[model samples]
Target: MNIKIGNNNKISSSTIANTVNGNMEFPKKSWYEKHPIIGGIIVSVIAGVILIFSFWADIVKFIEGVL
Candidate 1:
């Protein structure tokens, strides 16, 4: 997280924004062109849904009674 600066240091607003945001705001077409495996998004959404269902109150109560 530490950025080094020499005696000749020049700071730009875009550099600061990129550092804070982790990724640059590139165009969507350019991004997908570079990385086409967008299936990860669908997988992540499915995983989140599974986690929510697994922790639902009725499921938790049923498991607790079984234990």
Candidate 2:
């Protein structure tokens, strides 16, 4: 666009003003990553299962005696 200064003189829009912008894209996150509480709860449950299996000796003893 152009603006008239006087008679034959003129000025351009860009020369009078300027603008800058940055369009960016960020990596997407997984559902668990977006919800820390849920992810932590899941991890805690898995850890608990591991602990129970780790002490399977007690379970076997109780079962064999009842068998």
Candidate 3:
């Protein structure tokens, strides 16, 4: 219950009240809650980036061939 810091300072844990409220609840939202089209576009862009990175060498080769 008691914690000692440097130079003989002691703090009792029993005195401190829990600041976080147990009654609080976070609102759950679906992916399309904000905006479906915009969310889809964002997800598509992220997936495209991941795919590009996954096959970067092939993409570079294709670009080089076209150029």
Candidate 4:
């Protein structure tokens, strides 16, 4: 990603953080506050997906033990 330059032709931290390409832009606090439920659901879904993928073998073993 290219560094973002300000109007003065100097790079600032904020400009770098908020790059035009959108990779560095993350959900800010105000975004969470505005859509708390949506944010919670999104976070929960991401966590659930990660957990399932990371522990698929353990999860299958646990299910087999329960059966």
lDDT of 4 by residue, 1-67 (tens): 7655677667555533444554676666687898999999999999888887757888889999999
Query: Where does candidate 2 have its weakest 10-residue lDDT segment?
Result: 10-19
Among all windows of 10 consecutive residues in model 3, the one with the lowest summed lDDT is: 10-19
Candidate 1, 1-67: lDDT as tens digits:
8666654465444344333556778656675566667766767889888888745888889999999
Model 1 RMSD in angstroms: 16.1
Candidate 1 residues lying further than 4 Å off, grouped into runs, are 1-37, 53-55
Please report how far candidate 4 places residue 67 from its true position, in Å: 23
Of models 3 and 4, which has the larger TM-score?
4
Record all residue pairs in model 3 with backbone atoms less than 3 Å apart, i.e. clashing: none
Q: Put down candidate 2 lDDT per residue, 1-67, tens digits, no spaces.
A: 9866856674445354465557777899999879999999999999888887746888888999999
The lDDT values for all models are: 0.69, 0.80, 0.81, 0.79
Candidate 1 local lDDT, residue 31: 57
Residue 40, candidate 3: alpha-carbon lDDT: 91
Over 2-56, each residue of candidate 3 has an lDDT whose tens digit, in order, gives 8776457855555456686679887988878868899999999998888777578
lDDT of 4 at 1: 75
Q: State the TM-score for model 4.
A: 0.38
TM-score-superior candidate, 1 or 2: 2
lDDT of 3 at 17: 60
